[model samples]
Target: MLKFRELLVQSLLNDKDEGEEIEDEQDVPIPRKNAKSTHIMKKFEGNARQNRKRCISCYDKLQKEKGTKEARAKTKRVMTYCDECDNKPAMCLECFNEKHPSKYF
Candidate 1:
């Protein structure tokens, strides 16, 4: 699999270098293939290795999207996912306030 992946990557890189187009005369509608993946966790709650992947700002933003965070800890329920870093936690306020003080969503 390692060698296979390497070959695939090399082929991709080579393709980028080759500035040529290969097309068929007949128009062909390529059928898109979608595969469903099933994931199972062998161990749950692993040192946040997955969650820690995001920076503090993103973490807070995520919290805001979820409506988890607030401006002041005492007055508002600030988010924890660091919205500023995450893709802007839409529901969490704490994350939004980091960038946009008055976040409506």
Candidate 2:
């Protein structure tokens, strides 16, 4: 068993000395500089609309109606968000309309 191991090691060293390239089992090809990718890269937009967050208007209304403690404990979550607003406050459709009235209208 020892002699067989020694012969295998000697043969591998000899192969390196002979300048023969030893093929790897998983040989991945290196990408060229001018190579065009198959997949198309899409423009990255902001966060998805599906994300739910606590409504700021509803929170304020709750705070005004039932004290800050109760309002904090029972704030409602909504899907609507305003990217234009500072800090991007999440709000319901009614609240969004009320807060941000159309300048054209």
> How many clashes in each structure?
29, 0
Instruction: Give per-residue CA lDDT, model 1, range 1-105, as digits (tens).
Output: 434454468677885446555444344344323211111112223454443333335545456765445422323222233323335332333333444443223
Any idea what lDDT model 1 has? 0.38
Summing lDDT over every window of 10 consecutive residues in candidate 1, give the lowest-scoring window: 35-44
Off by over 4 Å in 2: 1-50, 103-105
True-structure RMSD for candidate 2: 20.3
TM per candidate: 0.16, 0.45
Residue 104 lDDT, candidate 1, scale 0-100: 29
CA deviation > 4 Å runs, candidate 1: 1-47, 56-79, 82-96, 103-105
lDDT of 2 by residue, 1-105 (tens): 334454469777774456655444345344433323222222224565546667899899999999999988898877667765667777777777677655443
TM-score, cand. 2 vs. native = 0.45
Whole-model lDDT values for every prediction:
0.38, 0.63
- Report the Cα lDDT for residue 89, model 2: 78
